[model samples]
Target: MKRYGHGLVLGKFYPPHAGHHHLVRTAADRCERLTVLVCAASVESLSLEDRVAWMREVHPGVRVVGTVDDIPVDVNDPAVWDAHMAVFRAAVPGRVDAVFTSEAYGEELGRRFGAESVCVDPGRSVFPVSGTAVRKDPVGCWDFLEPPVRAALARRVVVLGAESTGTTTMAWALAEHYRRRGGVWARTRYVPEYGREFSEHKLTALRTLHPGASWEEVTFASKEFPLIARRQAQLEEEAARAGSPVVFCDTDAFATTIWHERYMGGLYPAAHEPRRQHLWLLTDHTGVGFEDDGLRDGEHLRPWMTGRFREELARTGRRTVELTGPHERRLATAVAAVDALIGEGWDLADPLPETP
Candidate 1:
């Protein structure tokens, strides 16, 4: 028994907090057809794509659309309303029987289409959260944000260098450092080296399935490098989505690209295509000794590998910080760099680079 034939929920959804979700969901419940308009401006940090994605993810049944316009948020000005209504009509199309909002403008906006107004929590009593508050202190308002929004807001730091340059050690230390900050920054997460996971899986397959597989046999299997890159990418993205504000990745696809050159004889295009956003903490091979995990190429190969990392970093023009010295000193340097990057407004346009 729907009250309205069609419903429309429009918002800036700057970060798309829980309050916006409630309003949208409630409207969808009361209407047979619901459409959410995620209106954003160029000045906002969160992209229109992210806003639409979050809404659709959280409310799968409802139609979501994103539009970028510089229309001032002044409903008192009829000119502003006219411009907004134009954009709304373009985005939605067809007819709207109800306009849902938590603001007084709901009635006036609805009147544009001769639709009924559905206002909920105009006083903010139901969901005591606002977009402005969330923007000012996302960590403070973590509970108000959906997982996708939180994930979008989460900062990712990648540690990369030759094998055993204290990448894993520094990654965990960084996560612990943020975790100790506590409250909103409390649940820091560190992604382990996925190359190791790939190697282990291959070794298992060789033992059981192949029985007597050679290194060349496994390396030339055609699926090996791509699978590793894809799996590593998948793990990094999942960790980024659910991890704390500062998600520390032991190594990323860029590092995998470097490894692919060494182990797989050539670079795979997909491995090198990760969009450059992470503050790359390149672990210096100066003082740190390389430890041979059974999968390691060789101790001597590290300096060469480290050179390759430098080459790739230079080639990609990544935002990088070199970590050197003892474990504590290296961690301190990495932390400082990360803090500086954060201050400079480091964030993602989207959660991931275009990965195949």
Candidate 2:
């Protein structure tokens, strides 16, 4: 380790994983004080504040600054080089003696800043990690992240929509498709459908009770999304316990809110707001057709609800990979995609890997 003034790290820290922590800890130990810049949450990665909090926890006495409102700098894009450079300068007040990094970009950043550099090289030998790899196969990549993160991601994906639109059909098709193929990571757990569980529960519970019958009940029903969000967290914990990777829920907490609002004309935007980041798996409704299952509110209303779903998704600005084709086709497409990801070296042994 070469001596330097202060050690600084430049990264979005989207969700500080172990790899990041290792780098930071190393830098903090070498330099007198460590300064970390938290990237803006609205950037492409769109981080939640958890990463920043984790960094704080690690270096309780370290210097911290945040660029919550600044535009995120993607160093990859030469266009933002000057802009992000300017932001970087602004993030840390005047001259620092040194910058620390584990990635090549750190060297480049150090050169740009005219600062001495200390590098912490953590390649394959250090840890086979990255949040991107972990997210792609949370269950398989569980060991890469912290236990808390793993527990938060083992959720169940439930796909739902108006009757005949292929919710149950897609669910069962996907479940069977994945199961027959041995599923990802050689894990032997069945993908459960929310509707099946809901229906079964209804068969036994409806005989004794109804789905909360007041307008308030309907409004409350509209609020089931929060329950879904809560369940997302709960299920993540369950998957961790079961040693499964993160759940690939077909539908999600927001979907629950969307359905309730449609059925009861009641609003509960809060439920979906927090889960917006989690609803990354949606299909474009541009060319999809609806089947008649009698559970659909109406055909005329199909476009309306679907439109609303898209609109809300747009509001969140998350990308969507429209699952096209018939229900069977969509299932085949989803399974193939997951398989491709696995083959590409997405981790399958862990769920939410500790900060990596």
Per TM-score, the best of the predicted structures is 1
- Compose the digit string of candidate 2's lDDT tens values, residues 1-356: 46556878867655456777777777777777789887654533424465566567666778867775355445576656676677788878778878887776776688777887677764734767775665555555555656445434443344545434555556556555555555443342333435334534444454456654322222224444555556654543454445344245556555666666666687775634354223233554445665543223355666677667777767867544446666567777666655554355422232222222
In model 2, state the lDDT of residue 17.
67
Off by over 4 Å in 2: 1-6, 12-19, 38-89, 94-98, 103-116, 122-125, 128-157, 161-246, 258-271, 274-356
In Å, residue 298's CA in model 2 sits off its true spot by: 16
In model 2, the Cα lDDT at residue 12 comes to 60
**Candidate 1 per-residue lDDT over residues 99-158, each given as its tens digit:** 999987788988897898888899999789998777776666777877777677777889
Prediction 1 TM-score vs. true = 0.89
Task: Give the residue spans of candidate 1 off by over 4 A.
Answer: 209-223, 269-271, 346-356
